[model samples]
Target chain A: MKDNIKKSYLLNIVGILSIYLILKLLIGGNVLNRYHISIVIFICINIILATSLNLATGFLGQLALGHAGFMAVGAYVSAITAVALKSSGLPDTLMLVISLLVAGIFSGIVGIAIGIPALRLRGDYLGIITLGFGEVIRVIINNMKSITGGAQGFTGIPRIANFDNVFWITIIVVGILYALTHSRQGRAIISIREDEIASEAVGIQTTKYKVLGFAIAAFFAGIGGGLYAHHLAFLDPKTFGFMKSVEILVIVVLGGMGSLTGSIIAAIILTILPEALREFANYRMLIYSFILVVMMIFRPQGIFGTKEFSLSSFLHKLRYNQIISPRKEIKGDE
Target chain B: MAILQTTELAIQFGGLRAVDNFNISINEHELVGLIGPNGAGKTTIFNMLTGVYRPTEGDIKLDGVSIVGKKPYEIVKQGAARTFQNIRLFKNLSVIDNIKIAYHNEMKYSTLEGIFRTKRYWKEEKKAHQESLDFLKIFDMQDYANTLAKNLPYGKQRKLEIARGLATNPKILMLDEPAAGMNPQETYELMDTIHFIRDKFNITILLIEHDMNLVMGICERIVVVDHGKIIAKGLPEEIKNNPDVIKVYLGE
Candidate 1:
């Protein structure tokens, strides 16, 4: 397995170099330098949000519109934690990592609390409940004058989150998610998604798995929120309101509900596409809505639609690299 | 001695009583059949036994222990397992996975062990998969280990559902309309499989079947019902000869 991975890694390096050259040429050096770092950062954050939501919407087949509420919980928790411990003067990297993890756990707990009752609902009822819950969370934050500062926003947050931190954490979280979705738990979630009744008959404990999926999604959304809070050094309840929830939902839908790579690609495109067309900034929201509508019409399942782009499939085409053909019959000499 | 007994087991659906004072006693190693015309509450009885619905009023005892008011999973843990009248295999999962899921209740590893993929978790998972494979091999379905349940042939899908039920390692396996969708050959094969499970696993079976031939061929005892009441209970030959059984069957 190691040898196979090594060979694949070598090939991937070559592949990545070619793609980088192509991207560099298409958009000139100066523009790429200025926008590339931020675009990558946005892509990472959107991937976290999309993939996490997939755990609920795609795997568990629950449509939750309040993911941003969980994200807000994480962001605020992490922001408060960082600020409270500011006097201790912890290292920035360590503080950032700890804050993100704390945020994830906090959001996961809130997720479990919300999911228990909310997931009992089915179809559009679940959607409505989640939407209402999202608004409720925002209102609570807006009213909490002492802790959340009542709409003035939480400022002076430590700016420990940068492109590198965002990139690595996103990679790790996505990697963990990929592993989970392929595991037995992942299969069980997918099974529940396909048919909850059959899943229960097969002794799946469907509600437990559904709640588990929701908690996981919320955990990462929180982490993503923590990343967001630290990146901007400021946050408000409005930042993680219903429209923000819709923004993340757009990412999940446009990327294909079950397609991780599609989500990542969609994230990058959605983030940068607007700024590239900056002259039409007034119509930015309009363009975003239009793109989603067009994509829905053309390919409702999104770009990949639950299938991943396999480098192995591509490498199989270069069969000239193999010493022995896979199809060849090797028998004892006659 | 009877491993499972139901006394006056009944279910009421709105204005109508679906099952009225239905009683059954299944001894260890017996293959029993419950037959009735449509809407006669044969499936309703199975549902009651499986805890999908609580009995309107009756005592269901497994080994003399009352299982009344217990949940479906609670009944399952008490040495009873069942298949749905319509096959309810976990569709998106692999054939092996469908069976392994039934073994989830038997797992000894904690969630912490599962998350870290600890040694205990690996051992339990390995054993679970092995047991699932062994169960599938009984139905000659080990080759389709990776095939999704929905992708299997109809006959194999039915067999997979039974395998999943068997994976629970129940003392009594209840199959609802097991031969509902099969041709004669498949039905015959299923009959053999039912006997194989009974003899090999030393488990009793209470089956609700629509096919008279398959039911009569394997069931040591038969209970016939009509309009939610037992019309006759005896050996197959006696059930076949009973006047009321004939009237209920032929709609006389």
Candidate 2:
């Protein structure tokens, strides 16, 4: 069993590295146009946002509708910091890293602040509280014209986030999240989702884990927001409204809440589906809504349910179960 | 010395007094049973002891320290663990994971260590896994370690709930109703398991059960209650013969 675990880890690393190399080669060879590159970047950002929200909503069993609020917080803070540091003779890369960190921490702190009071309620009450909080964030951003540029949207932000930078960052964020959900702390959060009363009876501080999960989800959402601000070189409070939060939630729900791979796959498909159907631009949202309704009616647990896709496990099942094994006389091949 | 002691424990729900003036003292390694009819406030007393519902008035002490108003998790940390009457297992999680969740307070690794899979993290996790498997072995549930809790047979689910509670290494293990849905054969087997656990762990047990046969079979001392008050307290033989107990069970 231990050997199998090690082999799977090695295989996953190799798989990811190969995919990254292939993408890099395609972009370098000019096989993909600028529009395609931008879309890939958007997919990466969406993956980060969806996976983070999955931690809170899917794993923790808490419904939060203000995720884009955290994203907006990260965007505005990072954008302001970047603008302030641009003329301070700092390296662009260093400034970008600092700004993203600021964005993540700021949003994480806000998550905790909201989670404290919001998590006191459960089910639809919690969802409604988070929704209100999201709107409150937008209103705050709108009124703070000095820093956020009010209704005009914050501008003059540096564009440092590219395909390469975001790709690596997204990998890091997703990797950390995956590791978290598989760890002891992650188990505590999952138990809360399974049965909150039983979780408490088993010596788990349900409130603490709930707040921690919410804060971490907000942290990553903020990071994605920072990347967005840099990529667009502009920010609009209107863009991070309730509907934006709904879009991220839609990706998470469609991907299967507790499955990171599901989020990633759903993020890619949902991001590109509209672009692929651009001829029906006027009915873009209508088409998207129709797909979502159909998906819910058929598979309410999302595409993957709570199961993760493992390449090693799939290969093992195929080789051992489906294919008949020959006489085991040549077993020393390894 | 008494491992658990409750005095003047009471809780009121608006105009209703759910449990009033409930008092009990359990010594170390004692197998005590609390039995009463439905709505007799038996579970309410259990709730107060486990910190699910704070008593409107009274003091509960574990090893002589008052635990009143403490959170359920805090109470567990103070060496008290409990199983619910309705079999509250982590239904979606594996049986082994359910046991591991109980060992949360005992795990020493931090979140950072867990995220990075540091050496300490791997070591602690391996230890926890082995310990959990050993627990399953005691219940003869090692084979079902990977099975989801909800998929287990009714008897096994009850047994798993007890095993999960025992994983906390509590000084006092409170069981709300271990045989509520079990067959007679399963109930008989549960009697032996409860006795074995009490001897093996040397922990105090306070169980709330409705099955008189199971209660009489295992509990060394039994307390009978009716209408939020203790009606009789003695050996199972004495309680079976007590006039007040007869009145409560037979309804005047």
Candidate 3:
């Protein structure tokens, strides 16, 4: 069993790395144009945002609407750090790494600060509180004229987040989140989502897991923000407003809350959908709204529900005969 | 020695005393039942003992150690675990995962260990998987280990709840309406399982049950309550004959 687990982990890492390499090769060979590369990078950033939000909303069962606030925090902080380090003649990769880490940690700290008190509220109450917090964050950024450049936007952030960098970082973020939710701690978080009272009764420190989930989610959102800042070479408080948070939430809900794969899939589709429909550019928002409304009416639990797509499970199913396997019967029970 | 004891435990929601002057003493390996009519504060008493409600007044001790004012998970760590009146399994999770989650406090691997899949993580995870599976086997649910908890039949869900409670390795297990929705056959099997666990685990059991037959058949001693106060306490036969218990609880 241990060997099997180890093998699966290795397989997953290899699978992701190969995909990264393939994308890198395509881009380097100029098979993918610059416009497509930009879209791919945007998709990666959205993936990170959606997965992180999914941790809070999907796994922890907490509706958090201040995700973009954390992202803004990450974006500004990392961009500032990268800009400062650029003058120091540090390696670009090193500067980028430090900036992302700083952004993630700072955002995580903020997440804890907010999450501790905010988690006390549930459902829509929590949502409203987080939404207020996001606005508050944006307002703070807006007023900090010297540091954040006010409504004019913070500029001159180096474009360090190319397709390769953002793609790899997204994989790492997704991997960490996946590892967490699959562990004992992750199970505890999920249990809280299932039933908080029961989770406490069964010896899970509900508050601790709740905070952990929120903090981790915030950390990744921050990373996404940092990547966005570097990719776009700009930062605006307006970009991290409540609408941005809602956009991420929409991705999570559309992807299936508890499934990481669902988030990835939804992020890709949502990011590219507007650009792909460039011919009807004027109607993009309408199209997006229509799809969301239709999706909510038809598959409210999201596309994947809480079930994740597992490569090992898929392979195991293929290896065994459907007619002879008890596993098949077990799957049928679901 | 008593494994769990509550004295002068009381709670008031505004002016109404939800559970006033409630008391219970459960000895090691004893199967006890708390039976009361609807809204008789039976579940409220369980709530107080499990730290869901801080008593407006009173003391609760486990092994002579005061556990009053501790958190619910803290109380469980001190060797008490419970099932809810409504079964509270992690519905989306698998049956084994449900039991494994109850073993959360028991897992010694740190967060870093889990993330890195350290040697300790692998060893502990394998052990947890085996232990959870063994626990499911006790209820003849080993085959359903991979099945989602919500997909399980109602009777099995209840059984799984108990299984999960036991996985916490509590010295005293508090069950709320274990037989509430069970058919007679399931209830009968539950009774056997309860007996088996008490003997096998050498743990005291405190059960809140609405079914008189179930309570009377298994519980060596029964505590009957009405209006948040104990009206009668004695052996099952004595409780059955007690006029106050019959009037308040049996509605005779």
Candidate 4:
């Protein structure tokens, strides 16, 4: 078991480095242009968003709809922080890191504020309250022109969150999230999802776990927002509206809730697919949604269901051709 | 010494007194059966005892401390745990994980320790894993440890629920119709399991079962309720012969 853990850790580091190096090489050689590089960065940002949202909507088993509200808070907070820190003579990278942290912490605080009240309501009520709160955030940002620049959009951000920063951030964030979901705390969170009453009956503080999960999810969504703010050097209250929230939800649902690997894979495919289909022009959205509907009808559990895609397991299966379901084997034996 | 005591505990759902004047006292290591006909407020009493419902009328004392309006999880932490009448395993989780969740509160590692994977995380996690396996071993369910709860056979599911309830390390474990769906052989095995667990864990047990053979065969004392009232209370044989119990439940 120790050896397996070591092997997986080594494999993960190698895999991450390879992807980074390949992308870096592409950019250096100009195989991918500026527009394509931006799309890749967007994929990373969206992966962060989808995985963070998955913690609440997937692992926590709550239908949260206002994730964008948290992201909006992060973007605005980080943008403002960066603008203020610009004249402080700090190194660009350090300033960017601090701004992102501030963004995440503030977003998490807001998440806790909203979560305490909103989490008390379950299922659809929770969803609606989060949605309402999300809209409230957008409207507040829209009205607070002096600070947010309101409907006019906030620009002149540092543009420090390049592909170099975002790819690594996405990897680190997802890795931390993976560790979290596989731990003792993650069990409490998942148990709530599996059976809330049973979880409560077994001495889990359901309300505390729910709020904790919500706050963590919100915190990462804020980090994703911070990355976006600098990458594009812009912030639009309109970008963090209801439709944007839906866009992130679509990615998570498409990836299979509770599966972080699914979120990353789905985020990549969904982000790149539209860009690849830009030639279709007017019929693009219709085609994209049509594909989604078909995918849902055919495979409703999304790409991976609730199962994590394991590279080791996949390789073992390839070698041995063994069946995965123990129940099936037991039934057959009987 | 009463480990669990409830006095005049009652709840009314919109003027319908579902359970009124309910009183129960069980000593440590006692295996007591709560028997009642359908809709006799047996489950409701369980709910109130476990803090699922706040009783409008009386007080519940666990180990001589009043526990009214405390949440169900809090009650579990205070040395009480219960299984549902309808089996409610974490169906999506593995069998061992179902038990591990009951051990959630007892594990001391913080969330930050979990995220960072400190040495304490591995030490505690390894201990939890081995112990959870030990728990499954008592039920002789070690082989099915990795199987999802939903995929388990009906009898095994019932046993798993009992295992999950016991996992909380409760002073008094409550079983709600544990043998409800089991065959005769399974019920016999469950009866033995019930007796074994009560002695092994050295905990009091409050059982709500319709199977007279299992309940009467194992329960040291029996309390019978009918229409939200205690019809009779005594040894299982005494309750079996009691006129009120016979008229309401036995139906001679």
Candidate with best TM-score = 4
Model 1 C-alpha lDDT per residue in residues A1-334, reported as the tens digit of each score: 3355456546645665575566557446465574576666667787899889887897688999998898898889899988887778898878998988899999999999999999998879999999998899889988988887779999899888876567668867775776566445766687788777666665567788889999999999999989888887888888888988888888888887776667777888888787777788799878877888899999998887765544544456466565332111111000
Where does candidate 1 chain A have its weakest 10-residue lDDT segment? A325-334
Local accuracy of candidate 3 as per-residue lDDT tens digits, A1-334: 4465556667676777788889889988999999999999899999999999999999999998889999999999999989888888877667888999999999999999999999998999999999999999999999999998999999999888777667778877887887787779988999999999989999999999999999999998999999999999988788888889999999999999998888988999999988988889699889988998999999999988887766566666778734232222112111
DockQ of 1: 0.32
What TM-score should be assigned to candidate 1? 0.88
Q: Number of clashing residue pairs in every model?
A: 0, 0, 0, 0
Candidate 3: regions farther than 4 A off: A315-334, B250-252
Alpha-carbon DockQ of candidate 2: 0.61
Candidate 1 positional error at A144, Å = 1.4
lDDT of 4 at A190: 97
Task: State the displacement of the C-alpha of residue B180, model 1, in Å, after optimal TM-score superposition.
Answer: 1.8
Question: In order, what DockQ does each candidate have?
Answer: 0.32, 0.61, 0.72, 0.72
Error of 2 at A285 (Å): 2.7
Tens digit per residue, CA lDDT, model 2, B204-249: 9999999999999889999998999998899999999998988888
- Candidate 1 at B228: error in angstroms? 2.3
lDDT for position B182 in model 1:
94
- DockQ, 0 to 1 scale, candidate 3: 0.72
Q: Report lDDT (Cα) of residue A234, candidate 1.
A: 89
CA RMSD of all predictions: 5.3, 3.8, 2.8, 3.3
Q: lDDT of all the models against the reference?
A: 0.80, 0.90, 0.87, 0.89
